[model samples]
Target: MTSTDSTRSRWIRLLILAVVAVALAHALDGVAWRSARLLSVNDKDWGRLLRSMGYLPTWGVIALGFWLQQRDHPQRSRYAWALLLGPALSGGVAEVLKLLIRRLRPNPDVFEYAFRPFADGPLSNRGMGMPSSHTLVAFAGAAVLAQLYPRARWLWYTLAAGCAATRVLAMGHFLSDTVVAAVLGVAVSTLYWLRWVEPLPAP
Candidate 1:
């Protein structure tokens, strides 16, 4: 890490951060401008089906992955922990931000999505839709898995893309919400890898 190398790295990091910020802003704008017209009129059921596919099921997937990894690669159990943490922490952050922001979902009268919580019968709960927690968790989990198994990067990324698309199709989340979720997921996973997972001893 010479002075020149350090400066270059800093510039690259800053450039990436700026790009992420712009992408997030664009996504948020899309969410704010979302409308029912985005759904297809010809086949509503198909849209709904596509949306349903995006559901991440964070806990079950993480637990299952951990269990399988422990059984198959006991020496690499630490990687499983790292994999699990990405979704867990990202979801936690999304949930807390949701509470604080109190943005409403597309369907205020009902909760149809996987991440939808029980309505507390309050006005504050009416507009609670900013960042898509499901999308964030889905991408986070995907990214962690991809990092752990570089050979399967395409598969993990495909899953993440499906999750993001489903969020919009299901009408459970706006495009912006899913977009921000994706960004957050990637950011969290990247930070974890650079700071922790990458530094671990090889198996």
Candidate 2:
């Protein structure tokens, strides 16, 4: 490999490591913060907003927008597909992990640890909080899209972080869960890019 290519690879690896470090720090901070009773009025309101944002309807709209944008940009269709796959795969993996882990949601009364969201009976799922699926899927989608469109990468990342924060504010997951999910999502997306997405043609 050329020296320039080697340097580029080193830079990419460093960036990925930096991202992972940040995610871990955030997760640790979140867990410690949540464990305390230090929530302020503003924090409560923000939590509520985040929780509401975590709802499917809001995410559905975002997905629809992405779909439409992809349809309009034929040249970027492949990247779009890869972007979609990230979330799909992440969600699938989360489901399997959920079943295997059998962890309960924060709200034991409202949500049982079941395969379906609307399962009957008292919510039995109450204690298996390891990885936040919402955060994972959100990051997966965001990472792929951001990689494809570097110009507006911040927007995508902001949205993903908001979604992840919502999961924590909603008390749907622990801080560690969201942190791990973000890392996993980005890792998977980066792997896909390296394996499949062709880099820009040499100048």
TM-score of each: 0.66, 0.62
Give a tens-digit lDDT track for model 1, residues 1-203: 89999978986996688578657755564444454334452256654433333344554566576768566766566677666777778887787777665656666345332233445533243456567877777777777777767799888877776766665655666666777777778778778877867866654
Indicate the residue-level lDDT of 92 in model 2. 64
Model 2 over residues 1-203: C-alpha lDDT tens digits? 99999979997896788577666755574443355322342257655544333243444565566667667656555565565666777766666666566545554234323333435323333345556777777777778767767788888777777767766555666565677677777767777766776563211
- Model 2 clash pairs are 103-128, 104-125, 104-126, 104-127, 104-128, 112-123, 113-125
Cand. 1 Cα-lDDT? 0.65
lDDT of 1 at 10: 89
Backbone clashes in model 2: 7
Against the true structure, candidate 2 reaches a TM-score of 0.62
lDDT of 2: 0.61
